[model samples]
Target: MAICKILFFLLALCIWCGKCDVFYKQVGDEVSMKCGVDSNSNIEWKFNGVLILTIDGKSGNRRKGLSHIVLKASASGDILKVPRLETRDSGNYFCRQSGKQHIVHVVSVFVKPGPVLLQSSDAELHCDITGDPNKEVQWLRPNGQTYNEKNQVIHLKSVTSNEAGQWTCLVKDDLKLSVTLTVVGLQTTAVNASKGDDIELPCSLPQSVFQRVVGGTWKAGHLPKVSFPTLTNTPSKILHWNGKDLSKVNFTTGQLSTNFDVTLKNVQSTDEGTFVCTVEFDGEVRLSVETTLRVVDKHSGKTKQHLGCTLFIRTLSFILYGLKLWIWIAVGASSVFLIGLIIVIGVVIQRNKRMKKRVRKLRSMRQPLTDKDYCQCINSSYNNCYSVIEVLQHLFF
Candidate 1:
């Protein structure tokens, strides 16, 4: 039973040390790791299971191998230092002590190209890791902003100068690496040229980083994202225009320095958009500037956009004026009809009252009318009767 218990304890120890502690650092950074043991413990340090150093437990003395140029061991055998780390120094480090299990430390040193960009350019920053692809990656900006991205890449569209600073990459919320970004001003200009006329779009890098330009490109419309042309053995003096050879573009170079000013031979309406000039340096560094082109028709002496707007405005105004005049005319006709109807109705009501009074008088008169009554009726106008029907013979007929 005692032997069985010992075997179970050993199995548990192996399971406990199955996973290793991961550390992330950038190239040229230093790292220090610890061994979970005492100062006088008989610690044996190995890299990838190869014995590199052995420390004596009695005297606390350390013996390192010939490959220990940048690797340092503590006098107490409890700490190890790796300074000025490079890509080659990334691997698993093991600490084995007497009568104890192995402890593993995984070191990942990565290198990233620094991005020197122009304002209003699109860019993407990557947090590259060598080991543990499942590790969660996060980005922390200089302005106390955090982004928990699962893909380990942060895309910045239309990057401005305000976003330039040291950006830190956090892995598993424990490992951190920082990368610095530099932003420069991009000169912008608007050129208004007539269609079928020659126009120039000027673009240039900052004076500080101009001389290091190895290759360049001029892209029209929307700028591409990290897409560069294939370079030759030597630095390309000819700039790539619209993903094609430079023959199609009319470019002029300065006598002293390189200039990216492009002249359109015959500007057209299709050429009216943003044109971006990107200059490439060694180590995948790039800078870009942009300018806008506005095309106008030479015959009309106005842009097509302006002409269309003016036409629309004039037509709308005419329609509104005509509608207003028609509305007033309808209102006047309705008022005249209503007033005439009211006058006719009043005349009818007065005639009706006079007829009622004459009927009542005729009914009250005697059959044999007196001459005084007949004479009185003739003297008055017969507006209430159709004809003079006061005589008995006319009434009988």
Candidate 2:
């Protein structure tokens, strides 16, 4: 029975140790690894067959552990801690308990940064993964180059302009990483500013490469160099281009301004030209982008945009005026119709009352009062009371 028990324990050990788990950590982070179970007999940790830590309870064997490592015993389990983990810490760590045929735990550590590395130097992209036994990785660069290897990192060195694109990393369904590598350098995006308003001639560089930027310059057509800076530190330059006075250019005052973009203050009509931006960085010069500065008269009303806006306003005003006229005409016509209807109704009501009064008076008198006094209608110049037109002939007869 004891032999069978020993065999069973060995089988369990083989099974548990066969299962390897992946744990990801960057270089400077603290990591805690659990032994999964606490043994009363002995507990030991190893890195690639090298004995790292041992806790012996039976014979009281105590040994010095790795530097910067702390072993913690708790109700849950035994914990191995690293205060500040390094790149060398990346490997398989084995934890074992004494008299146990099965391994307690297997932890595989990896060191790398997060995705999307933007830098002036070479970029290193990482594929974060866990729970894969094969530990295989596939990499695809922006230049359509492919790599299939066990390594999880793709180191790109001496990157150039055309190399700026997407990089893909994959471990099938278990892991995947997509990263964009943007090599920051000279470039221009168009912007519009009024003649008198200030403008920024764009030249942008990443903050990580700030040391490489020696200086920047701006020029107008083939004329003499328009602007150059006196200072070594700041990105701004004093205007010297054209026959234009240097006093007109002002350094936009800021202690920590990033953009090398120049500002032309109180711009005039002569300032219109194809302005070019040339930047010198890291002992090399590159011409970046050109902006067309078209300065017009400062008059507010005559500009093309203002004219289009004014025409739109006039069209809208005419529509509103026509609508108002139609509405007023409809209202006046309705009022006239309403007044005429009211007058006709009042005349009918008065005629009905007079007819009723005449019937009652005739029944009471039983004699001819006067033809003119029996009925009254004032439709015309005639003032006779018996003025029913259909009965006028009978009354006369």
Of the candidates shown, which would achieve the greatest TM-score relative to the real structure? 2
Would you list the C-alpha lDDT of every candidate in the order shown? 0.60, 0.53
Specify the poorest-scoring 10-residue window by lDDT in model 2: 99-108
Cα lDDT tens digits for candidate 1, 120-151: 55667877554434446777887869865655
TM-scores of all candidate predictions against the true structure: 0.43, 0.46
Model 2 lDDT on a 0 to 1 scale = 0.53
What's each prediction's clash count? 0, 3
Error of 1 at 59 (Å): 5.6
Q: What is candidate 1's CA lDDT for residue 381? A: 59
> What's the residue-level lDDT of 330 in candidate 2?
71
The TM-score, computed over Cα atoms with residue i paired to residue i, of candidate 2 is: 0.46
